[model samples]
Target: MKPIFKRPRFGTTSTAFWAATIGLLLIIAAVAGWPNPVIFVMGAILLATGLLIWQEITAGLWIGLSVFGLLTVLHLTRAATYFQLRYLIYSLAFAQLGYECWRGLQRTRDGIDSEDIDDENGDGEEDKPMISLVLLQRQPKYLENMILTKVVESAWGGDYSNSDAQSDDDADDGDGFVVGESPMFVIKAPAGMFLVHNFDVPYWDNKDEVVEAIGELRLRNAVEEHTAWLSVDMLTPGDEEPDLNEAYLLVAKLLTALADEDTLAVVRPESLDLNVWSDDVVARLLTPGAYEELSLPDNAPVIPIADDAPEMRAAIATAQQRWPEFADAFQQRASHDKADDGPSFVVKAKITAGDSTEFIWVDVIGLEPKFVHGHLANDPVALGDLKLGSQVEFPIEDVCDWCYEKDDEPVGLFSLEAIRQIQEAQQTNEQ
Candidate 1:
């Protein structure tokens, strides 16, 4: 048997019809001069009060009472001619007010709460799949007319919003984003569809500058991260798993080009799903020198993932699938095989001498005066650059700690995790 469907009592069409009828009456009353425009406007307002119980009980009640009081006073004091012309209009408003009061009370007695109205009408629908992106130290100039645009254009499917207003050159300008400005855009690709929008970083000193790039990916999901890493937010259609193959191809094309330019980046999805990322794309990013601290600007921080983090493991495993060279390099670095003669307690430290601190990690070999004895970490791209892996000594008070490698004992300035693990182990042993 076919299912029976009931018509909604207050659907859009019925509401529109009533609203239109009242509006037409207001226009006719103005022409005939039967009632003042104020009376007809009050009548229209009463209709709104009848539709919304909360409004009728709240502000609407006071408005209705005031209008009636004013009209009654005017009727008693005014001449016969004045009362006769406006009587019909005033009566219509009064009848509307009475109907609103009656309906509002009836709805309240029936236990129909205002909040449930939207649920009954299915007004709050689920959003489409989406993801967000954030880019730091952004160079919009690099994205202009580059191979990156070509890849995105090649996958150009179409967009929901106007695309004619935007061009690669237009997006390249710093005017696209100003301090406190968040612009939104939509781009379609054969691989997937998504939106791009900006968010403010209030804590950042350059809040007003358009130097940084931050964006969202509608139809894809994003996860929060401590470090400045590019998030892989590929979009997908509803009720469908993401097409990993297409996403991988797109990422490979984009990241490979980025790496060729020696761009130091750390990109991850808002949420990590191994099935959504192919092996090639992961290897391209995690490849040893692809995004090493040494390759970045002096003192530029690394991605901040712990040695044993799942993301690092995933990258390593993905690298093993297609890029053995990157896999080997990633494993070596993840193992912490950097050259240093200092004790395990002496973690990597950055020197803060002046306006710009030294950009390389130093080996703290001595205490008392706090001496650093080592060359700056070598940058693969610019090997042996000046000040890199250079030996320098500073007061113990002058060094700023960036990160701590895993180590045992109450070594100098170890990470909180290392300290907590040691205390737990010691407690268990005593027990």
Candidate 2:
């Protein structure tokens, strides 16, 4: 497999640690005239770590370290009486690595200059925004609250001097400060939106309103002129895009329109990328061939029936106890579906067993895939899941198998809240 690890981004925390570790080794090699083999090994490490840093300041460090270590190795090994000759090659390698690192940073940074075109949906000739978008699907409100607090605190406490120097440099370059005081924007759509917001907001409340309104608007689209009920069926092959997905595309189209009209700030989350979970729940539920099912929340607000719906409450609790993964996915999915209108491009999955192979659909349903409304499947069906299909296997196994064999259905998923209620219900039933 191509490397799973992301090469280090310069200016990140990890780069510092790597520098320090390499620094200590170099010092030992320099001071004690360590063995030739040990010295060469240290130099090799320096070369590798420098490349991984992906930035001039840090990458140069590795080159320097490598050259120093290499020279020390040559001296200790006594390869030649004329150390001067050997120094020439090591010096050349050092210069080459340094020049490459510096030029590479400029080239890469230059590509990202398209940040000036805020009106485009990050589709310009330049690199996609230096900004990374993350999705926090079907996350619990309690957990969100805790994490959000940290984000706000980090923003407030972060150093601004470097930011100021950078801004000045951008201005001097004629790019004219590609970004302002807020390098990041924070907005929340209770459900989710497929479109990333890109405008200035005076307060968090306004941002929240704009996001929530988008979700409300998209939900309106799903319903007909006069109907509380929504009709969803087997997705035709050509109907690759779901209703929410279409809503998101419309959102992108609208945002693109706005960008064309004005100089927007490009409202986007600071940490909305996905690093984990539920890649197959969508296919298992929607595809007929897959034979899995679930009742969607369908863009409705969760009217916290905290004291009312005894069954839902019980189900949440019981599922949490018996199937933590299911309960988590259920609650997360509920939040995701109810919170936004943007399409969360969920993945479609297919699984094959002894005899037949089946297709299933899975995805972040509401607008934005990130935020509260994410989940894996945990439907609690009748027959147990045979766990067939090699394709169905994923790093994230949030789905719970209830029925298999004759039932021949896929597993169900749930967010944490749903599992909590399910857990309670199971306890009640057992008692």
The best candidate by TM-score is 1
- Residue-level lDDT of model 1, residues 372-431, one tens digit each, is 344445321122333444566655343333232434334223234443464466469979
Candidate 2 structure quality by residue, lDDT tens digits, 256-370? 2222211212222322211111224233222332211122222222222233456544543443345444334445645666435432323222233455433233443332222
Cα lDDT over the full model 2: 0.32
The candidate scoring highest on lDDT is: 1
Candidate 1 stretches greater than 4 Å from native: 1-132, 142-235, 243-350, 356-361, 364-372, 375-390, 395-431
**Local distance difference test, each candidate:** 0.36, 0.32
What TM-score would you give candidate 1 relative to the actual structure? 0.30
What is the Cα-based lDDT of residue 140 in candidate 2?
Answer: 12
